[model samples]
Target chain A: MKGLTLSQRVAAKTILVIIFLFKLRNRATRKKIAFGIARIIFALSPKTRKRSINNLRIAMPDQKSDDRIRYLAVTAYQYIVFGVLENFWFEDIEYTFEMDAATKALITSGGPLSIATMHLSCYEAVPFALQKLTGRVTTLSRVPKFAAGLHSVYAKNGVCCVDKSQAGAFLALAGKMGSNGVVCLHSDHFGSDTELDFFQLQTGAPAGPAMLSAYAKTPLLIAYAVLQKDNTYIIHIETVSEFPIGQSPKAFQFAMQAIYRQFESIILQYPEQWCWFYKRWR
Target chain B: MEYNQQLKNVLSEILNIDTSNFMHSTKLLGELSELDSMSIVLLLIEIEKRFSLEIDIADLEAKHFETFGNLASFIKNPLTV
Candidate 1:
């Protein structure tokens, strides 16, 4: 086995201690620490500040003011920090949803279900909450190279993460649908195999979920967890039927677009909560 | 009766541009000027909605989007033929 160098060992020990300290802190303390980190990031990173402003400009073309943009950028940074902290504190937190009977019926039905989720406030918390509320839950996510420990935490919580980079991951995911598992996936990010036309721009977005659903002859449900002013999340669940069973690929892409349009509407409503740090249009 | 022309008409309407100005030879990105990344995505959505087709990511190629005529032809009778 390869041994760690003195610096590497020290860094590893420091990170371990930080993680332990973070876990030991109360929720309020975590929020304060996250907010402090956000403020520091805002003060230090000029590029991120500029990018946030540019993102808000594109998202809201009509709203033009330096002060407003700056405020939005700061708020977005705070949200990003809070989101990260939420991931750590998610296991202890609880959420309440006011889903309609129709939505509940679709969720309770023992069949393959696909959930379309965007990067919203405490996005990870939604699935964690769902696993607590509904036992069957899985999420399509790219495995982070540095976050092997985090993956184990997610696994412990019953949230299955599918590495998007794997060749046959989509196929395997499609096969899993037969067991009536709830697969939650983000359709916003750009992917090499994806066709363009997202967020009023030409960029690749993976069509795997839509294609998998079409192939499996399962239902695709659109759901998003948005944070309200009072810091509670409202999970909006809606079923879009534009993409019928056995429809052609183009029809499925169109259906995906309709779903994306709904996501855009949600992002517009809460621009600060959206993950603007990502190169979304690119 | 060719599906290529019909597809071109649909593309023109969605983009709010004149079909008469578009040619089979005109490229989508640089040549059309109006066909940006967002437009391309919107066009794909419109195509899927109108024609009931789903496009795979691996199937996309830059050359496929090079010309209006090329896109029209591809959509009219995809390479699957």
Candidate 2:
């Protein structure tokens, strides 16, 4: 922290203040405060509120009521804030993982696997829980500072992170996956010229998981952790690559489309838990 | 420009736009509102189908999609780029 820039030091201090405040409350009170803060942010920030509204409109055009869509947008904002607040509480809480027997076997086998996940509720917990099942889990993340905070709590919890901004980062991730490591990728964002159909609209979807699985010659899996009413998280994991992994770009497109279809289904099921403020379709 | 008619056809279909006025010098990335992230991806897929070449994500750049001519050249010979 001595050599850090002023902005970084301020950011770190803000995070510390959040954690200290979070530490003052029990789980139930913390959740209530988090939800209240989210509501305030949603009400205050017109940009996020509008973006969420527009995203939901594009994602579900036939919903037929603006009020319903607006409610979902506000709840989505709350969920995102709640997710951030819960990051401070991950170490003390126990998350339940729900998957089929085959899925469990695939994760427990500790073989090479690539997981594609999104910004769903408590999405960060998927990798944390996976590290418990397998001995190691690696992830490509963009934000190093945020990850550093989580690493302090889950210190050496077998989660290896590589900054995605560096050149040849994908090669490094592929090398890790080549050695039978589980690499978790946040794949719900847009990438140039990597198109896939999501919610019947065309948008750029990351082809990393599909391409990495093919390169690594391992099964590609999709997982998401959603929050329940009882202040607990339930992680759902599934395998998407049922047939032989194809190396062609066409194969990558097909695999990604299938993955987004699954993502859309999950979002539709838990609309409030997903991050709709993101310009996903744009 | 004549060699790019097939390219224009594929682009129009994938992007759901009328290619009546799109010249080889037409700006794509910024000028066209239809060429957002999703259409850009479908544009690559359609280019792959029309040209029988597979374009990797690494081969993609803003310059390659700046204009219709640039896009056509990339589709014609992606590996050399």
Candidate 3:
């Protein structure tokens, strides 16, 4: 999103057209068509393909055999592509919310909640679905300027998108949480200052999820929306420790590690669905 | 000394760094292993809490976080102009 040529932007717009057209088809058909488009993109984008393979190698060192890693890389691309296409018609995708009793009580307790999540299959749907249960949900996301038109549609829904580039974005997030709103943060990527052992690799992890939860004294939870073969999404929610008031540096590190641990486990389970093309460890 | 101690305490608390040895010459930003984009934000948050000043990320530059002295000056008066 940082660097995009005019042609690339036009190409993305063209893909959006195809995504819009696919919306006319049935759920299963659309998904199949989306996967087909994704496969083609996977084949064309060598950078993404290579990055995915590299990521898998780093995260899953025991996963020997190039063929398996290659397949997973391509499939990961397909998931990323399908995720983009699905966002066009996310309303059509049937979804169910699943969480433990304590997690459910924390969310429904009528207090502010902070959700730490990753860019998994249908990751955008996490907030989209959560907003159905929780009244207003604000998410920190980076939508390229090219797709501003499409993202505006998502903004029309209760899920407000805060551009990560904006100065003092955390202030907005903290304010949202202070007002008893749900703030969902995607922490899978390398966007922050703190280092954590993710997949046995020390990587810079965002301090947002922990800092926000601690500062706002909100219940922190980790969640994901996994796309099933039946064209349905199951949003699984679990508890990340609630931020104790006046969180110390040790507590912050522990919280960050806890979030990443859950993320690593989820990625291990659905390696193909997680976006692995990015330089996650760097 | 009051503001300096307060700022050091904040940096120590957020970054888990022992700031006792930190002095005016203590380098930050690229020089400090713990100071990065994420830590910068955390530092800003902590600075706001300790010093009661608002930091506009848009207005922030590398110089503001170059050294402990710079950061302390910024905290004493967060004039990003």
For each candidate, what TM-score against the reference?
0.71, 0.75, 0.78
Cα lDDT of model 1 by residue, A1-282, tens digit: 026566655665665566678778876676678778888888798888777777777777888688887877887788877876577556666567766777777777766777777777677776676676678777866644444455665787887776655534554455466556777777777665446566567666766557656655667777767766666677777776523334455755776787778878878888778777666666
List, for all models, the DockQ compared with the true complex.
0.03, 0.05, 0.12
Q: Share of real interface contacts recovered by each model?
A: 0.00, 0.04, 0.07
Model 2: per-residue Cα lDDT over A1-282, one tens digit each: 566677877887788788898889898888788889889988998998889998898889899998999999988888888786676677766678888888888888867888899899777788878888886788877765633565554444567877666544565676677567888988888775368788778777788887777655678889999988887888889989744367666887888888898988999999999999987777
TM-score on B-chain, cand. 1 = 0.75
**Interface RMS deviation of candidate 2:** 8.7
Q: How far is candidate 3 from the true structure (C-alpha RMSD, Å)?
A: 6.2
> Per-residue lDDT for B2-48 in model 3, tens only?
98888889999878989999898898766777775456656766677
Q: Cα deviation in Å at residue B18, candidate 3?
A: 18
Off by over 4 Å in 2: A144-156, A242-244, B1-81
- In candidate 1, how many Å is residue A128 off? 1.6
* Residues A1-282, model 3: lDDT tens digits: 346688768866786777668877887887688788788887988888888888999989998899999999988887877886777777787899899899889988888888888899878888888888887798987776777655665775668888777644566676677678888888888865467899998888887777777766777889898988777889999988754434555667788888888888999999889999888877
RMSD values, in order shown: 9.9, 8.5, 6.2
Tens digits of per-residue lDDT for model 1 on B12-79? 87667877666678766556656643355456656766666765433545566777777876675654
RMSD, model 1, all Cα superposed? 9.9
For model 2, what is the error of residue A113's alpha carbon versus the real structure, in angstroms, after optimal superposition? 0.4
Best by TM-score, which number? 3
Docking quality level of the chain pair in candidate 1: incorrect
